[model samples]
Target: MSRLITLVTAMIATITTPALSQTCPPPLNGAVRLVLVTAPDMESTGGLLQLFARETPAHAWTPASTPHPVRLGKHGLAWGIAFEAYKRGDEREKTEGDKCTPAGFFRIGPSFGFVASERHNYITIKPGETVCVEDPASPLYNTITQRVQLAPETKADNMADTSLFRNGLFVDYPSDRANKRGSCIFIHIWKTPDTPTSGCVALPEPQVKALQQFAEGGAVLAVIPQTARDRFPTCLPDMSAPHDP
Candidate 1:
């Protein structure tokens, strides 16, 4: 009787240990939806981006849409200070005007566009009417503000003059409200496959349109570096699980 009990216990442990070890990491907790952006390396400006959705946190991510080719920052990627870093005191590897795309998990914020009646979720913009605050000395640094809100002499980038800002979604980096980690990170329209952005991710216009239709508020965009791809399962285990029949 004692031998039989030991055998049964060993079998149970074998069955359950692997499953529990494969649980999703903290970054993905409570995220029922996500967008994964992957590059070949920290220096590669081109890569594939895909959107995924799940019915619940415990379930696997299903392909919500097709993968889109995208462009990253001109200088490549660097680690940005986000929620996880804020708690742990990780050093920020990127700075303002570094021209490097930030690699981390960021919440998706409001969309902005030039057309008032555009078929997407975005704030309307008139030429020279919108600006994103990049001045660290100002209280609104790293935020998007209307031109009317600023003094005439205040330094800010004109979002309208650039065709890229005609339609775009905000990426909420620097999750800490009080500190300025980086500014004006966005997913916007790309000029061409060969052209890299200042620090934002760029997609072709048609894919940008598709993204506008697919993305929802409160979703997270996770930028994972290629060198770390092997460890991705430890961070997002649902993606590794076998599909349900």
Candidate 2:
């Protein structure tokens, strides 16, 4: 009888333990929904200066892997982030180049992508869509754009400039250092499930999975330079006001 009771207790423990351990709890307690950027210096991380929403203290909730030096947009004027989340190819070392990414803030967004695993998602952009790249007259020039092909290498031809656009993040060229710098920057997914990017930051599969859960239109990401964090204001009202034409 005692052996029978022990066996039953063992079975119950096994069943209950597995279920209890597998469940993921909500985000860390009181972890404000703000985007946090980290630099190689470690302490330099946490440049959470931008305000994402008006109602909540959080400006945005970005993955822990989002890159630094967030950029802000100029004209279209919405909060945005520029990250090294996606790379052009499988080579991880490609991200080492200095010119691979833009430095300052730019208007970003209008989330795009098909659903992946409900916990992993990404925005898709082609190679020649003509996103803004700081060009003066190119309509959508100086803004985010997508191109139709992958840039084999970075050069005067493949660089993020005014001629091309990638279907990812928008570019905002401040007047101080303006030019037709071409575009095709993206806020897409990593090359591999566990891979990092060339010039964009990477989010865990789970965070992106939460994208669809947020309210639309009012969402925006603010990317800025490491220096800009201290200079710019923290938190802003939802700039995506309703359009009335």
**Candidate 1 residue runs with Cα over 4 Å from true position:** 1-27, 83-92, 117-121, 175-180, 237-245
Listed per candidate, the RMSD to the true structure in angstroms reads 6.5, 17.6
lDDT of 1: 0.71
Best by lDDT: 1
> What is the lDDT, from 0 to 100, of the residue 111 in candidate 1?
77
* Per-residue C-alpha lDDT of model 1 across residues 1-245, encoded as one tens digit per residue: 99999999999987866542255444466676687888876777777788888787656677776666788888877777743342223323667778888887777777778877554456776777788887766677777888888877777888888888777788877633345456878899998888898989898887876676666445778776666556546554223221101
Which one is best on TM-score? 1
Per-candidate count of clashing residue pairs (backbone under 3 Å): 0, 52
The alpha-carbon lDDT assigned to residue 15 of candidate 1 equals: 81
How much lDDT does each candidate structure score? Answer: 0.71, 0.31
For candidate 2, give the lDDT of residue 101: 38
User: What lDDT is reached at residue 113 by model 2?
Assistant: 42
